[model samples]
Target: MAFDYDLFVIGGGSGGVRAARLTAQDGHKVALAEESRMGGTCVIRGCVPKKLMVYASEYKESAELAQSYGWDFDLGPFDWPKFQQHLESELGRLENAYETNAEKAGVTIYKSRAVLKDAHTIELADGQTFTSKHILVAVGGHPNVPGLENADLGMVSDDVFTMREMPKKLMIVGGGYIGCEFAGIFNGLGTEVSMFIRKAQILRGFDDEARGHVADCMKMRGVTIHTGCSPTEMEKRNGRIWVKGSSGHEEEFDAVLWATGRNPSTKGLGLEEVGVRLDRGGAIEVDDHFQTAVPSIYALGDCIGRVELTPVAIREAVAFHKTVFGGEPTKMDYDLIPSATFTQPEMGTVGMTEEQAEERGPTLVYATAFRPMQMAFAGGEERVLFKMLVDKETRKVLGVTIVGPHAAEMIQMAAVAVKMGATKEDFDATVALHPTMAEEMVTMKEPVRTLD
Candidate 1:
């Protein structure tokens, strides 16, 4: 059967781009279609831009810390427009890089929206259709804003990049990492920030103790955290958004940002019409190999609702290419995947949480919390928590969580240990570096408590 291409990707996200590039590099015909920018969410709107903003927000504290170190200077107001301009420029550069890489790999680039016409046929917005031997969907996901009065009046995480000015008083809804992160960001940038969470704490589904520490740190930083509550209504008047809280309190703010959650972007793609199985969350249902029920079609990344991380998606793409094109079967390993939340204090986590470990079997918990030397000497009240969950029977480190500065960097190394199935003895046997927060991970020899 003759086809227009050997592989046709319906997205230009990390997963799709990697797949297209790898397939083409493997001497196969590949074409990738993306209606929007090439880098997809992580590069264009999500992680990259968000981390830049996090860095920008941290400068306020950076300046304050410098003052404590005998530096004298009054920082000026944050230049949001200037930062935004620079951010957009950088995004443009990245988008161009994605396109360039794809073109260099001999993959055709279609700057158009694509839909499934059948298991192997993709129809573009321009009324052009192309057939491929196999199809891959990696369109990614979008922010899920619930239906509410004047909901459009609020902004999502993606819209933060487009904001022309910083809000004086910002109301962030939801208590997830996205919401908590922006709370820290806006608060650090000198905004009177308030967060409304339906749950009692932010960063739900994470280690309870670690999440509690993060929420406490956020509160100490002057973020007005409203737990056990949410916004019921939003109204606009006098250029301010009036939010009616579930507690029957109404307040107005310069802007409202919704970081509630994300839904798989499988809308209007005609997946069902073509016999692609979709999960209840609208994510494409695929097997361990990422092959959809329709063997000719496949999906991965956030669109499949499986470990929606940029690196994970890229790995999945690599494995998919190795399996289909290179004739080597491969499966993605989801265990011990390290993740970082860019909040004020930051959080790095990998493997199971304490609760998750306890549920599996007998677990020994090694936990420590103390103010870091730098912050302590500088007369700061901030603290860091380091915890390790180990299997008592096997002595294997089941999970590791750190909440404090440089946690993201520390977790990367910790993840290696967890992935290698390093036991508690291995950590204790290692020599500790002097005057460092990371040394705590190795120095904690005895279990604070054991769970059977």
Candidate 2:
């Protein structure tokens, strides 16, 4: 049967937009529908805005560092409104770029939500229906606010960008990267930030030593972290929000943020009715090639519950295009994927943690923690950590974890080495760049302890 378009993509997120644009560029008719902004979460409200805020928040310390370095200046109070205005303008520019690129690639753009009506049919929010040869769903996820009494009084990550003013006292819930990163951001921005984490440590899935270093740094930076705690209820009282924790501790704050987690934005997409299977967490079930249970329908990115990063989504989109249209089947590589948490000090990691590597085989761990030259010279107690995990038998570097200034930047290069299966000897053979925090990665000649 003839179709209205060769492909219909149900989202305008990084993944969806890339897939739609690539397919259209291949000379196939492609159409994309987005319920909200063009750049989806990452460009619209997630990483882009968050990173900008992180930069904005760091100026207070930057000024102090400058003063310690013999530069004279007074750091003024953070102007939220001015920064937010610029942020909004930047986001608008990015959204326009996404739309312009898609249109230039000859993809039809629809500013409405699209849902599946059948294996090959999609219906827009306006009740307009269209049939396609293939359908791709890349709707991303949203911050999850736990269901509790007066939970609506609390804001999620998405609500942070829209806040008219920064809260004087902020109570953040959850221990994941979102919670920790925002804790650092708000605290740096001069908010009295308090974190209620259900886990023993802030970053549960990260390396134990690295997370410990981060938690210590966050506490030293004036973030009151209450580990082994979670909010059981929230209520508005006397112009403030009061939260009762699972540990029976109660606190009041000017604002409450629930960064517990995120759920895939899959509701009302009509996937179940169209014979597409969904996982227990409401994520769409897709095969290795990103093809859904129904052959004509495919889903990727956060909605599929895989690696929920923007780069991963774009890679999946490229892989999908190559597999379905380019006649070269490709699968996304999930190994050696580097990630970072933008807390006060920051952390960047690629490959297995000491715990994970030990579980696989005998491991050798090399680690160092010391105040860097800049921080030490400024009379600051902040320390940087560099750790490398190696396989005892194979001598291959199993993982690299860094916690300190530009950890994210350092990890990108470390990821390249790890991806190439560089061994500990290869790292050792590289000459150390003197007086640099990164030099420690190459200079750790002895294992702190070998785990058999």
Candidate 3:
């Protein structure tokens, strides 16, 4: 069978770009199509830009803390325009890098949306068609916003980066990581932030204790969080966004941000016409090898709704290349993947939570909470949490969770230990570094609680 290319990738996201580059480098005819930017969500609007905003927001706290260390200066208001200019410049550099790498690998770039025409043929938005031995779908996902009264007045997470002016008062609806993170970001930037969550607490799927610690820290830092209620209707009045809550409370704010949820970007890709199976949430369903029901097609990353992290997408791409092109069979291992939430007191976790572990079998939990030296000396009430979950019979560390400063960095190191099936004794044998929050990971000798 004659084909225009050996592989035709239908997205330009992290997974799609990596798979396209790898397949082209393998001396296969490869082409990738993207409707908008090259670096997709992570580089353009999601992780990179969000983290930069987090950095910018943290400086106000840093500046205030400097006074305790004998530093003197009045920090001014946050300059969003100035920071946004720099952010756009950095994003441009990244998008160019993605293009350069793909071009270097001899992959043809199509700047249009591509959809499956048949099992191995793709049609683009601009009346172009290409046939390949195999087709890959990696379109990722998009923010999910419900249709409510004046909901269009609210912005999603993507809109936050491009906002023209910083709001004096911001209302964030939803309690997921995105909402919690932005609440901290805006609050630290001196915006009065009010978070509305329909649940009793934020971070629904995380460790309860860790979630509690972070929620407490956020409240102490002046974020007004409303739980057990959500916005039922919204309206604009006198230049302010008026939101009517489920609890019979009405509040007006300068801006309202919705981080409700996300849906897979699998619409109108002609998946159903080509006999590809999608789950109830419209996420493409694939087998263990990421192969669709049709032998010549495959899907992965956010479109599959497995793990929506950028690194996971990149890994999936690599595994896909090895399995299909490299003459080596590979299966992705999804165990013990560490993740972090960039909240005020950040959260990092890997493997199973205490609730998850106890549900499986007998488990032993070690937990500690204390004020860090820096915060203690500065007369701050801030605290750090370190917890480890171990299987009682195997004596293996099943999970690790940290809530406090540098939780993200510390959890990366802890992930290695948990992934290696290190036992409680392995941690105990590692000598503790004195006067450090991380030392708590190794120094918690006794079990705080045992679950039978």
Give me the runs in candidate 1 sitting further than 4 Å from their true place. Answer: none
lDDT of 3 by residue, 210-246 (tens): 9999999999999999999889989889999999999
How far is 161's C-alpha from truth in model 3 (Å)?
Answer: 0.8
Q: Which residue pairs collide, candidate 1?
A: none
lDDT of 2 by residue, 167-226 (tens): 999999998999999999999999999999998898989999999999999999999999
Instruction: Give TM per candidate.
Output: 0.99, 0.99, 0.99
Clashing pairs in 3: none
lDDT by residue (23-99, candidate 1, tens digit) is: 99988999999999999999998999999999999998888888988999999999999999999999999999999
Task: List candidate 2 stretches off by more than 4 Å.
Answer: none
Please, what's the RMSD in Å of model 1? 0.9
Q: Number of clashes in every candidate structure? A: 0, 0, 0
Cα-lDDT of candidate 3 = 0.93
Cand. 1 TM to true fold: 0.99
Clashing pairs in 2: none
Model 2 sits at a Cα RMSD from the real structure of 0.7
